[model samples]
Target: MASGSKWTYSQNKRFEDVLAEYAEDTPDRWHNVARAVGGGMTAEEAKWRYELLVKDVELIESGRVPFPKYGTPPGEAAAAKAAARTGRRG
Candidate 1:
């Protein structure tokens, strides 16, 4: 709960949940998000975190950042592996 401490996984998840509960136009949204996020997070910190999250989403949506390929299909994975071995683009 120290100032400038990094948010833990649980804290981030809770922040996302609480943020979803409060709309952008909601009164005192950042205050409510901060209180729900707990860990002594202030409204300013919550707003800052929200801004960072928005930027991250924008970057991902713009395709400047590659999306994670967690559930790639088996055939696609095999093809990519073969392409790599043959020094070819998939």
Candidate 2:
């Protein structure tokens, strides 16, 4: 996480989305994510933020932390809604 500036929910969601699209663990991949994140974030900073979110997501999934109800983080709700509409699992 960037201690220099707090990341809002929307920013974190954007990071998660970009991370998913650029899935591979590579220097270039992090740079791509950073570009998507914008705000002059460097690849190193993006990587740090990503790792923090990954851990939080794992904790949430494992019931160590409550799933955030503030808003759907990224995939979960969107997929569920799409599945409901299509009458198929997302």
What's the TM-score of each model vs. the native? Answer: 0.68, 0.64
Clashes of each: 0, 0
| lDDT of candidate 1 over 1-90, digit per residue (tens) | 654677665666688999999999999999998888887889998998889889988988999988745555567889999999999995
- Reference-based TM-score, model 2: 0.64
- Off-target runs (Cα >4 Å) in candidate 1 are 2-4, 68-90
**Pairs of residues at least 3 apart in sequence or in different chains that clash in candidate 1:** none
The residue-by-residue lDDT of candidate 2 on 17-87, one tens digit each, is: 88888978665997898888888889888878778878998999999999978876567888888899999
Model 2 deviation from native, Cα RMSD in Å: 5.5
When summed lDDT is taken over every stretch of 10 residues in candidate 1, the lowest stretch is: 1-10
**Alpha-carbon deviation at 25 in model 1, angstroms:** 1.3
Report the poorest 10 consecutive residues by lDDT, candidate 2.
1-10
Top TM-score prediction, candidate number: 1
How far is 56's C-alpha from truth in model 2 (Å)? 0.3
